[model samples]
Target: MSHARRSVLVPSVMAFGFAFLYVPILAMIGYSFNNSRLVTVWDSANSPTLKWYSALWRNQQVLDAAWLSFRIALLNATGAAILGTLAGLVLARFGRFRGRTLFTALTTAPLVMPEVITGLSLLLLFVAMEQTIGWPAGRGVTTLTIAHITFSLSYVAVIVQSRLAGFDLSLEEAAMDLGARPVTVFLRITLPLIAPAIVSGWLLAFTLSWDDLVISQFVAGPGSSTLPMVIFSKVRLGVTPDINALATLMVLTVAVGVVIATVLLRRQERRRERDLRLAAGAD
Candidate 1:
């Protein structure tokens, strides 16, 4: 009887936990279809409608904010992936060198740093740079993208470094043995092997940048508001069905991206398995 009770208790607790986490999200999604303009209220008199989704397209401010956010995210992810890959390669492949400890510390610092502190520090740095060099002109998309890239590179670097930790160095050594230069070996062998990690890092960075509000709020100026900022401003006024619809659309987009990434990773795994089998047979 005690064993049965324990089992039931565990399942009951798990169900409760799941409901606690997902019930609000589910409710939010449901309310996106609500005919009521107010997000929180569901009226029995009115039927569910798709007007909010249509209104989303007509909302020029939201559209412009989303576009700017996408552009910044795209650029930030690309830049972070490149810089992080290089930093990861240095950490993973190069032996101890001058300032290695400092480099490692700086690369990983942002992972643990508070977002508010990072944002404030970056804002100060940008202000100082503008005063000194008279460049950047003012806070805007450029500064926002740079700030996102700065914080995001640490995450990408960690991912790439972990991917490289288990990587076989013998392949690179063999390429070099065959008279391939270091650059050639990296471009041909190392880069291809680590391509998946780079892609993953890029996606992670993009998501971080897209979802960032604190950092963007600090760095952004007039005419450079992001989707998160827009949503936040609307939320402050009072939640609207349009915002709910926007959030639901974002959730759908992220879900679809996850599904596609999963499929691609599975295909890559299958291809890798086939290649391993062919290599074994040849041996």
Candidate 2:
């Protein structure tokens, strides 16, 4: 193709791609401010009220489900971060220990495993454990959190491991050479360096847990309906302005989080560069 034609085609395709991906979200946000009861109709005569937003605040069921999902996501993210960081450390630094292959496979298996299979397997595992040990009593928030953590940890592990792959081991070795204990070196040196990846992993795990539906369906008890579960049920009945408002709020939240993470990561990167430059100058 000619350069002019190629340029036109590229811009057209890019615009189309953006529109395809974001038009629905933009539509949803627009409908959240709709004054009409019908979700799609624009009541331009008395349009753009905060009526749905107010109603969403008063919605007890949605509030409860949101709170439950938030708590579970928080727990899942923290647990996954800790466990995954440890696993990543082992995998990246342990240097081909016994059972290393098996360990690596098991740690990463969930990434490729189907949600249905994972959910079913976890359900069975919970049932068997409960039957044998008489623990957990019944599935609810606890079960949901556990199931989310089980899968989410793998994602964190992968992120942390990837971060460690190109890590500067000289700093760690220097710390160790200076008579610092391994634990101290890790706490003071390694952890700070890899903080960005850990934060990213935590955010990813939280998102996964918050957005999960199929797995939560299998492991959750009758009363432990999460935000996603509630949203799915409500959607089947009909699209309402309140749901749209809720979605808009969630979108705003995710947008803010992405911005914050980006800012923090950039600052960390800048600081790292400055330190390296200072060290180089001194040397």
Estimated TM-score for each candidate: 0.92, 0.94
lDDT of 1 by residue, 1-283 (tens): 7688669889999999999998988898999999987666786578488889999999999999999999999999999999999998998999899999999999999999998999999999999999999878899988998999999999989989998997879889999999999999999999988888898899999999999999899989988999999999999988789998999999889888978997997799689879989998999
The per-prediction CA RMSD against the true structure, in angstroms, equals 2.5, 2.0
lDDT of 1: 0.92
Model 1 TM-score relative to the real fold: 0.92
Give the clashing pairs for model 1: none
Report lDDT per candidate.
Answer: 0.92, 0.92
Worst 10 residues of 2 by lDDT: 1-10
* lDDT tens readout by residue for model 2, 169-195: 898999999999999999999998778
Which ranges in model 1 have alpha carbons more than 4 Å from their true place? 1-17
The deviation in Å at residue 238 for candidate 1 is 2.5
Candidate 1 residue 255 Cα shift, in angstroms, is 1.2
